[model samples]
Target: MIRPKLELADIFRAHGPAWRQANAGHVSLGQLKVMSAIEACRTETLGGHVAGCASCGHHHIAYNSCKNRHCPKCQGPAARDWMAARAEDLLPVEYFHVVVTLPAEIAQVAFWNKKAVYDLLFRASAETVMTIAADPRRMGAQVGMTSVLHTWGSALTHHPHIHMIVPGGGLSPDGTRWVPCRPGFFLHVRVLSRLFRRLFIEGLLALHRAGALSFFGDLAGLAEAGAFAAWLAPLRKSEWVVYAKPPFGGPEAVLAYLSRYTHRVAISNSRLVSADDATVAFRWKDYRIKRGDRQRIMRLATGEFIRRFLLHVLPDGFHRIRHYGLLASAGRKANIGKIRALLGQSPAIAPPEAGAEPVPLTLREPCPCCGGPMRVIEIFRRGQKPQSRAPPRDQAA
Candidate 1:
């Protein structure tokens, strides 16, 4: 496969030092660590291995990956492992894709109080969905959903939203049978939007009153109770975004969607066009424009680009992906079994091959010359050179 002309590492390598020096006080320790990790990823600084094909004697060197969750190069294998684990949880039912977005007012507050606001976003959205679905007038069933948080827009701007993959139906309240939603719809978006807005604001206020939320910069004045209430007043009446996309064709489509979103970074290497001493250029979509016009190029000075990228480095230990209701960790196994039984589907089984140890998932490249599997015969530590090995007799002089 051909390598792209530019990558996130390229931008970081070119301007990371200067950016760190210039904004030493402004950048967080996590952001700085991310920069260093990206810069060193898959490079000589981290050490690697040399793989050679026994059949064709074709040799190649493979560098080590940083395995940082935020690295684009490292997401592939991580996503695969995650999807594999989630495969058993899939129900043979139509799946709906829903997105819940925080309004600009809350987004600004979230920018300063990321951990708190993001937690609220997840809790409020999950509560909104399960609440609406449980209502007798609505679906009247217990639904399971996997929600993933995305905090950046196409241009790497701070835009926090939750993407949820929901089965089109759920278990009946009595847990005796499957309850299917309307053939073409999941729930009323208007109702969800209103309830989501109310829940989120209420949660935010509760956090503030408990002194869990912090305000800084321009928002410092909002620390006052009256001022915070006033700031939230307009938001209560403002429309929030909560929309469900058309149902995915089947389980396959849901898995495909999850593969892309479950481990995505702010920007992918493919979207990167070029990186130079002063500026970095990348592709971005302006959704407000027509479809054709939406795909456009955006260029930012290297430092600014780094800054924008760092804006998405989540608070340490924060979970960006979450499960709710029936999928909640505590009782997911039992809930899934009940759901499968109610749907009249047998439990999924993993096939085993006699005398075969399971092949661990990886993203390493195959042998180029013979198109065979490649394995590391030896490992080298950082700053150490790989030991030279003699070529096969066929190539010996």
Candidate 2:
């Protein structure tokens, strides 16, 4: 039976042609291909081969997955794997959540230069935090943080913001001790906003000077350096928003938050309710409200849904996930080692866990109740339906 919370895969399986018609001119050819690939995931479109248990004379057919990061059907495993790698980075200190948002004036340029601007957003924000925290007059410590880029608002609109989960403390630059922030406070938002604005404008100017930004239609005038500089002039005087919320529930909550934000796209498939009659309904969270007041339901035309989702289509091969400061890629291993030494803890490593690796089909059949290994007793080939079997005890007996 079809359900309201069905995913894109289920939606397309139910109404592929109608969705295609609605999105024909709105979505990019590549996006359409992604949609098609998602539609065909775990189906016969990609073809499959049968596997059999020779001893038990049992078999089943397995289908192929699209594996596109944007495809809803594939993000689950991807998120899980990402979380597994990051789980060890958690520090034993209080963590804070800060969000730095872009002003409407820059949103236009950001839309065209997502990779560049977003990269700058991360850099500028990280630098702002480190600069403020390390000042002798301020927190005066090297602070470590993990930042996630969120490019959408609650309504699926393009409102770029970076959500950072930062530890309450950091290693002293000399790597001798961990310095913690004052209780209930991290860094000065006013100072952070100023630095963030300056850094971001500089990065944008660099991109513009290098001819890396694309302008079209109404924005064509911005192609000139004078016009671009003039546009940025007011932004310098205007304040950028750098908001810091209260400390999270220690390190655990911080990791939980990171696990959600780092992998988020414009929307998740689970939020989807239905796709029919050229409209799609879904759920969203309104972060501006009190607790228990955040969830809301919304609907949009199929074309608009596709448009919003595609708005977040990153430049190909751009690394959405990144590390900076202590987590910077170049010397992360050594840096982490040095940090652990200062904290009086060993360099972090993954601990063994059951089922950490993929479980094979053969390992799945040792029955817990019967203490016996079971094997597939029959083959279910492609295009061949499984025959009806004996009913459960309640119905058969």
Candidate 3:
């Protein structure tokens, strides 16, 4: 067996409280809850159970996981559950990965108004894709997309962007047949960049008019209409960043990519190099650098590291994953069925029964000594030790 490396929980357990006390005024309730949850995740504070091997009689204690979306240790099971539900939605076609990123100016405002700005980001990107695809000169189909919101960059900075997994084709406007895109191409990035910019800026202006946006710190003056319009002036001429990667090899590749991005938090435990009382070190990628020099180490004071991690807590109940166009949940089942029928393919997978419990992927690892299944023979309450079971008379001798 291999031991796990350093984790985010370790850093939180060591420095969370001190950082919270120093920045109590700046931190939100949601951020504080996330910090507390990460600090106590999988520890005795949460609870645990005891599992024993029936063949070898070997037993070990296992702690409960926090199950918080922000917890690094909890995302594996969450991603698996999400994937199970999404398996039925796969189409028999190539998929494209498109990214829409906000300029630094907008990102600065989005830092304080996360919910509003992030919602605008999703709306603008989805509209751009669907609108362009529907044009008769373009793909001339109604595409479906799964868009995920990511608020942090590789260095854990507040760089807001959208990651969209889009099928390479769509249903005809009349729903009579499947419409496929060009073999390996999806959309023109330049066109998407222009439309996304117009839509996003227009939405931002509307939000400002409705008094739904707030400006503060260095951007406080933007509350005035003149200042806000002036702030957006340069953005109109500057090209927005919209990138589209080549089509995925197949459906399996799309699932593999979604598993990584769907539930990712600011940073994963594997990137953490070390943490101490005064400072922490971690690996980060600098995309601007050459490929071989991209990987680099970043060290920051413990408090600052914690602060940067908390920068992405998100407003409570704000969804980071969303679907649009044909993939929208309202009628996704019917839409998928129609598409499959048109393509002369059978259903990819059956949907789960109405009230069935999700089947566990694996109950437990095999016993190390006997290679037999392990069973949870007893459950121990928090702070309680497992009671020892007496041995058989022959074995006692």
lDDT of each: 0.87, 0.73, 0.87
Best by lDDT: 3
Off by over 4 Å in 3: 1-3, 351-371, 382-385, 388-397
Off by over 4 Å in 1: 351-365, 389-397
Ranking by TM-score: 1, 3, 2
Q: For model 2, which pairs clash?
A: none
**What lDDT score goes with residue 239 in model 2?**
84
**Model 1: per-residue lDDT, tens digit, 73-168?**
889889998998899999988899999999888899999899999999999999999999999999999998999999999999999999999988
Highest TM-score model number? 1
- Is 2 or 3 the stronger prediction by lDDT? 3
lDDT of 1 at 287: 92
In angstroms, give how far residue 139 of model 1 lies from its true place.
0.7
Candidate 2 Cα errors over 4 Å, as ranges = 1-4, 12-26, 47-62, 286-292, 346-397
Give a tens-digit lDDT track for model 2, residues 1-397: 1122477777655666666675567556766776678787766566544434434433344445678777766666677778877777766667888889999879888887787888888888889888888887887777767777778887889998888877787777677888888988888889889989998899889989999898877888999999989989999999899999999887567766776777776777778877775788889887878788788888987767766876777667777666767777776667667766777776687667776753344424333234344343433444554343422211221
Looking at model 3, the pairs that clash are none
